[model samples]
Target: MDADVTDSAGTPADPDHRAGDTPQGRSQEEPGATDSTDGSEPVPQKDAPQDETPQGEATDADAPQGSGDEDKAESSDENKADREADGTGAQTWADHPKDGSASRRKRPWLRWAALGASFLVMISAGAGWWLYKKLDGNITTDTSAAAELKVYEKERPTPVVMDAQNILLIGSDSRSGDNRKYGRDDGGSQRSDTTILLHLAADRKSATAVSLPRDLMVEVPKCRTGDDKETREQFTQFNSAFELGGTACTIRTVERLTGIRIDHHMVVDFNGFKDMVDAVDGVEICLKEPIDDKDARLELPAGRQTLNGEEALGYVRARKTLGDGSDTERMERQQRFLGALVNKMQSNGVLLNPTRLYPVLDAATKSLTTDSGLDSLRDLYDLVRSMRDVPTDQVQFLTVPRQPYRQNVNRDELVQPDASELFKQLREDKPVAVVPADELKEKEKAQDEKPDDTGSDSESPTPTPTYSGSSAADDLCEQ
Candidate 1:
C-alpha cells in the first residue's frame, strides 16, 4: 500500500494542466522530494469545466489552498494564454475558414447583387433629374408671341374641342448665327420656311398634319411687331405674316384662316432640324433619281439610301432640283421625308427608351422656340406621352387644297370647299379619312377609262370624302 504524501506547507499536490506532464509518482520515485524551484504548487484542472473548456485552460476551483495572490496570478496568466492560443469568439468580414476543403455559401453573392441593384437605382434617379433640367433649359420660350397673342385675345377664336389640341409647327429661315452659312441675313428678317398645322384628336388615337403653302394668298389680321408697332390687316402671301410681325403675326393669320383656336406652337430653326435628323442616325428614303444640288449642299446616289443631318436638311429644303421643281412638289417631298422619320422613331422604340430618346430631345430642344404652354419639360413630356401610342397609320400628313392663282401664276389660292371642310373636321375633332394622292389619282383615271357597268342614272349614295394624303405607315421603299 502507498503512503499518502504532502508538500512542505502540508498541502496536497494537484494534477498538471495536461495529465502526467510531471508524473504523479515522481515523489515515490524519490523519497521526501519537493519542487526545487520556488516550492510553489501547479494549477489543478477542476477550476474549468473540462467538457466545455478549450484546451490549456484553468479555473479558480483548481487553484491550490494557501495559494494566496501569487498562485491566483499564475492561474490568470494561464487562462489568458489559453484564450489567445485557441482564438477569441470574434470574427471579421475578411475572415474565412482556415480549412482548404471548406465550401463557401452563396449568401455573399446575393448580398453583392442587392448592393449593385441599389447603386444602379440611385444612379438612374440622379441621371433622370439632370436630364429633365437640361431639356427644360434648352427650350427657348416664345414669351413675345404669348404676350402679343394675349393683346389680341378678344379677336382670337375660341377652342371648340376642349380636350383636342391644335399646334402650329413652323420651320424658321433666319439667316443668323449658324444659319448665316446658308443665306444672307437680309437685315435679320425672320421667315417661315415651312408651316404645318398639327391636330391631335381628343381620344389620342389620331394626329393630322396639314402643310400650309407659304405663297398661298391669305388674310392677315392686325399684328404687333418687335418695335411694338401694329401692322394693318390685309390680304397678302401667307409667309409675309412671319417676316413682318414674327410668330405672333403668323399665328394670327392661321387662326383667322382656319377659324380654329391655336393651342400651342413650336418654331424649329434650320440647325435644329438637321441635328434632330442626325439624332435618329439619319432617315432612310428611296429616291427615284439621284440628287446633286449645289445650292442645297446635297449629293447622294438614288435608290434606298440613308440621309444624314446635312443631306436630310438639303433634301427637305431643296425646291428647284427635285421633282417638277415646284414648291408644291417640294412640300410633297417634305411630307414623305417626315413620314419616314416618324416611322423610324416608332419602329425602333426610340420614344420608349430613355437613353435613346435623350439625344433626340436634346438636339431638338436646342433649336426649338415654343410658347409658355410647352416650355416646361413636364409639359412637353405629357404632350409626347399622349401621342406615343397613336398608331403610325393614324398620323396623317396632307396639304391644304390649293391651286395656282389665276391673277398671279407664281402664287397659290386655297381650293374653295375642300380647305374649309378640312379645317371644320379638325375643329370638331372628327376623323378625316385619307388615301395616298397617287393612288387616288390612279383610281380616278381608271374610272374615267373603264365603261360604267351600272346603267342606272339614279344617283348612288354619297360616300365619305377621303382626303389625299400619306401616313407614317406608308413605305417609301414599296413605292
Candidate 2:
C-alpha cells in the first residue's frame, strides 16, 4: 500500500519514494486514511492515489530526495571554485595562462624542426673543418731546398728592330719519388719537364703561348747552391737552374736568355694537374695519328677522342715516333693540346660546379710553389677573375719559330727573319700577322734580297726576350 506524500516545502510528490516518519502525530489515523492493521508503515509514492489531503503538504519522497540533491549541489559548487582558483578548466588558449602546457604544445613540431636543422648545420661544419685539417696534414712545405738556390743576373740580347716577349712556364719533374714511372728520371738533377711561355700584347688584345722544348740545348748560368757551409756554384743545363736555385734561378736564366720580363708565374705538380683535368670531367681532342707512347704509359687510337689525365699528359709529352720525331714537333702538339684543354674546361662547367672545382683548386694550390705575390688566396682569386672573362678564341698558342741547328744536328736554333718578326710583335703586344701565304712571300723576298748566296750580310735574328720581374707567388691554383 502507498500513501500520498508531500515534500517539506509543500511541492508536488515524486514517482519513487522511501518510507519515512511523518511530521504529524498520526499513524494512518487521520480521517479517510487507509488502515494499517498489520502494523507496518505505509510507503508514500507520487504515482499512488491518496485517501486524504493534508494542508500545505506535497510528496514526502521529494523532501528526502531534495536533501541528497542539496549535498550534490554543494560538492559541484566546490569543484567549480577549485577550477577557478587553479585556472585550469575547459577553456581555450585565449583564457589559459601565457606559459600554459597547452600553449607550449602548439608549436612542438616547429621547435623540433628548428633544433634538427641546427644540429645538421653543426655536423656539416664539423665535417668540413675535419676534412680541411686532414688534407692539410698531407702537404709538405720545404723551403730548405729552395734556400740552396742561387740568383744570377746576366746580359740578354737587345732587340734592335723588333721587341718580343717570352714567358717560361715550367712544370717540374723532380720526380725523384714516384714521378719517375710517369716519364724519364734522368738521375742528374731535378729539371723543368714542361715549359710553356705565354706572350700577351702590350694592349692585351691578343696572346701567344710558346712551349719551350725541355730537350733544347741552351747555356745555363752559374748558380750557387747552399749557404757558406756547403755552397757551390756551377754551370749546367738550363733545367738544372730550377734545382740549383729554385724558381728564382730559373726566372733569372730565362730572363737572361730573353730580354723580356716575366710578369707572372705558376707551378703545379703531377697530382694537381690530374685533379684539375678530372674536375672538368676530362678534355676532348681530335687525334689524327694513333699514339702508342708507352713511356708515358698512354695508348690511344686515332679519331675524335676524350682524354683523361693520363692521356692528356701523354699527348703533351710524347716525342718519340711522332710527327718529325723532333722536340720542335712535340712543342706544337703540346700547344694544340693545351688549347683544346682550355676549351674543354670552359664547356664542361668547371667554374659552375663548386664541389668539383674547389677540390681541384685545393689540390693544385697545395702542390704548387708560386711567386710570393700570388701565394695569398685573395691575390690568386683576383688574377683568376681577370682571366675568367677572356674568351677561349682570344687565347692563341704558338711556338718560337726554330729549325735544326746548322752546326749541331741534334739541337734547334731560332728560324731567321720570320722568328725575329714573331718576337717583335710579342714584345710590342701586337697581333702576330702569321698568315702562311703572306709569311712565305716575305721569306721569298728576304731570300731574293740576300747580297750574296752565302747569306753572310743578313743580320742574324735575335732570340726571344724574357721578363725580369719580382717573383710573387700569387698565381697558386688553390688560392
Candidate 3:
C-alpha cells in the first residue's frame, strides 16, 4: 500500500513528495529568503540542482563542452611561455610551422659567402706584404762607397738648377767570382770596364747617357782608399783611378774632369748583369756580319736575334771580332743593346705581369750596389718612377767629343771647345743638341705631309742643338 509523506512541520503532503524538491522550490519562491534568514550575503544557488546531479552525468556534460575550452586556453598559454623561454618567436618554417622561413634561410648562406671572401682578401694582402719584404731584402748597399763619399761631400758639384739629376753607372770587370769564368782569373785588380754619366733633364722630358772611354788619359787626384791608405796624385788612365781607390776615387776624378756634380752612382757586376738579362728573358740584337770570337766565346750568324744572358755578355764584350777592335765601337754596340733591353723591360709582358716583374726586380736589386742616396729598394723605386714617363725617343746616348791624344797615339783626348760646351750645357740644365739628321729629315717630311686641318696657331718647340748621338727609339737593326 502507498504511504503518506509529511513535511517537518507535520502537515499532510502530496502523494509525489521528494526530499531535495523542497529546497529548490523554496529558492524559487523567495530569492532573498536565504539572505534574510542567515543575515549574510546569499549563496548562488542557480546551478545547485545541476551540482546535485550524478557525478558521472555531470562530468560527461561539462567536461566535453565548458571544461574542454578551459583546457585548450591553458595549453595555449603554456605553449607561448615555452616559445618565450626558448627565444624562438622568430623561428623558421623549416624549424617550426611558420611562413617566410625559406627567405630567411637563404640569407645565412650569403652572409657566409661574404665572410669567406673577406677572409681570402685578407690572406692575399698578407701575401703581398710578404712578397714586398722579400723583394726589399734582396737589395745590397755599399756602405764603404757611402762613407768614403761623405768625406768629399763638400767637394761635390752643386746643382745648377732644380730637378736636374746626374747618376754614374759603373760596370766593374773584377775577375774574382762568376766573372772569372769569362776572363783571366789572375787575381788582378778590378777596373771600370764601362762608365756612363746619365743626365736627366730638369723638365724630365729628356735623358742623356754619355759614355766615357776607359782609355782616356786624365790626372787622378790623390785619394784615400777603402783601407785608409792614401795614394799620391798622378797622371793615369781614367779607369786607373778606380783601381787605386775604388768608387770614391773614381767619383772624385769624374767630378774634377767634368765639373758636373754626380747625384748618385751604381756599380753592377757580371753576374748581376747576366741575371738581369735573363730575368727579362732575353735582349734583342742585330748583327751586320757573322761573329765567331774564341776570346769572347760568342758565335752568332749575322741578322736579328734574341741574346741570352751569356751570349749578351759575350756580345757586349766582343771587341776585335765584332767591330774594328776599337773600344768606341763596342760602346756603341752596348748603347744599342741597352736601348733594346729598356724596350723589352718596359713592355707589357714584363712590366705588367707579376710573374715576370718579380724575377726582374729580384735580379736587379741583388746585382746593384748604390750610393747612400739610392741604397734601398724604396729609393731606387722613387728614381725609376720619376723617369718612367720619359719617352724613348728622348733618351739619348753619346760619347764625349774626343780626339787622339797628342802625346800617345793609343790614348784619347777631349776635343777642346766641344767638350767644354757639352759640360756647360749639362751644368746649366739646358737641352743638348741630340737630333739625328735622319730624325730631322723625318720630322721635316711629316710636317710637309700634314695638312693644316685646324687653323690654330701653335708655336713650335725651340729646336735643340744637334749633336752626334743616337736615341733609344732608333731601330736596333738599323745600320
Candidate 4:
C-alpha cells in the first residue's frame, strides 16, 4: 500500500492554502496581500455577500477539484485559523511546524561538541605558548659581558670560517646564593673553574671541545672591571683573567692566545652543573680505584658505577685524590666524564624523547648565562638540534698541547708548534683526529712488551697524526 507522505515528527503533510478555502476564509487577511498558494492570483473581496452564499454551492471554475462537503470542512478550518490570527499574534517560524522544519533539524549535542573541541584546542595552544615563554625567559642574558666585549670589538679577532662557530664554555665556580653549599661564599667572587673552547664544524658532522688549564700562563689584556675601571695588562695565569675582569676579560685573554674569534659564550655555575647531571639521571663511568675525597664530598668504590650530580661534580673536580693530582689530570677527567654524559644522552634517547628532553632543557637553561646571540630558547634549541645528528666518534674532547714552563715546573706553557698547528687547523675549519686515552695506553704497553728487532730491518707504516684525547664513543670498559 502507498503510504501518505508526512512532515517531521510524523505530522500529516499540509500546504499553505487548502484547495477548499472560500473567499470569506481569506476575508480576515490584510488588504492588497496576494494569495501565496501555488502562485495563484489575489482573492479580492469584491463580493462581500459571498460569505453567506450556500456553504456547499461551489462554482466549478472558481474552485479546485475536491468534494463540496470536503471543501466546506477545510474552509471551516481556514476560517478558524484566520480568526485566531486576527485575535492573537501571527506565527513565527519557531511556532510553525512546517516553517521551523524547513529552517533546520536541530542536533544540539553536535553543536556542543564543536564548541567543546574549539575550547580544548585553545587551551592546548595556550599551554604550549606559555611553556615556550617560560623556557625562553629562563635563560639569563650576559648584557654586561656583551657591553664589555663591545668596548674591545675592534681588538677582537675576525672570524675565519663563515659557517663555523666557536663558543667559550666557562664553568664558573661562584660560591654565591645556592652555590654556597658547594664551597665558601667569597662575597660573590669566583674563578673559571673550567673553560672549554667548543668548535662546531661548518658541515655539522663533528664537534671538538678543547679544555684550557687554569694554570696555563698567558697574556691578559687590560679589561674594564665591574666598577668600570680598567687595569694594566700583564702576563699571568689564564684563570686569573676571570677573577680579574669577568667574562669579557677571559674572552680577551683567550682571543690573544688562540687568535680565533669567540662567537658566543656561556657561564654556568656549580649548582647548574649538578642539576644538569641529575636531569639526565646519572652518567656512568668505570673507576679503577676507590675514591674518598672530603674536600670534594665524593666517596665511591672501584667498578662500573653511575654517578649522580653531586658525586659527578666531585669526581670531576677532586684534584688531589685522582690520577697524578695535577690540574691536567683533572681536566682530562672532566672531558672524559663529559663525553660519557653526552653518550648517555644520545644512547638513552634523551634527545629524541620530549618527556625526557624537557627536564634536561630546564636544568640547562636555568643554569646558563649566555651572550645575546644564544640567550633565547629558540636559538639554543636550534643550535642543539643542528648537532643532534653528529656521530659520537666525531665528537672529540682534548686539551691544547702544553708542557711545564721553564721558569716554574708547577706552571705550564703551550707546546709551541703542536699547539699552534692545532689552533690553525681549527681556525681554518679543517678536520682533526683524536685517540682514546685507554687505547693509547694499551698500544704503548704493547710496544714496550715487544722484543727488540735488532736483526730485522722491518719498517713500520706511517700513521696519521692524532691528538691524545677521547671521543663520546670511547668505551672505558674496553681499556
Which residue runs of candidate 1 sit more than 4 Å off their true CA positions? Answer: 1-123, 442-462
* lDDT (Cα, tens digit) per residue for candidate 4, span 1-479: 01111111133234665766523322234532433446565544332233433222344444566745664453334434664767532332123344232133456677789999999999999997888898898899989988888888999999989999999999998888888988888899979999999999999999999999999999999988888899899998999999999999999999999998999999998878888899999888888999999999999999998899999999999998989999998998898888888898999999889789888888898989999999998999889999999999999999999988889989989998889888888998988888866766787689799998878698876453467898999775543
Candidate 3 lDDT over residue span 27-109, tens digit each: 22333223223355544333233334322222435454555456445434444566566654422223333333444564788
- Candidate 2 segments whose C-alpha is farther than 4 A from its true place: 1-103, 128-168, 183-188, 199-207, 215-219, 226-237, 376-379, 416-479
What are the per-residue Cα lDDT tens digits for candidate 1 across 1-479? 11223232233345544764343322322223444434455322122223332222333354346643664343334444553555542222123233212122425676699999999999999998888999999999989998888888999999998899999999999998889888889977799999999999999999999999999999998888788888898999999999999998999899999999999999999999899899999999888888889999988887999889999999999987788888888887898889889889889999898888998999989999999999988898899899999999999999999999989989999998989998989988887877888788887798799998688889986565567788999987876
lDDT of 2 by residue, 192-285 (tens): 7677677755444445676655545555655455433322444344566676666656665665655556655667667667666766767776
Output the TM-score of candidate 3.
0.73
C-alpha RMSD by candidate, in order? 10.7, 16.5, 15.3, 10.2
lDDT of 3 at 71: 40
lDDT of each: 0.82, 0.56, 0.76, 0.82
| Clash tally, candidates in order | 1, 37, 1, 0
**Candidate 3 residue pairs that clash:** 433-465
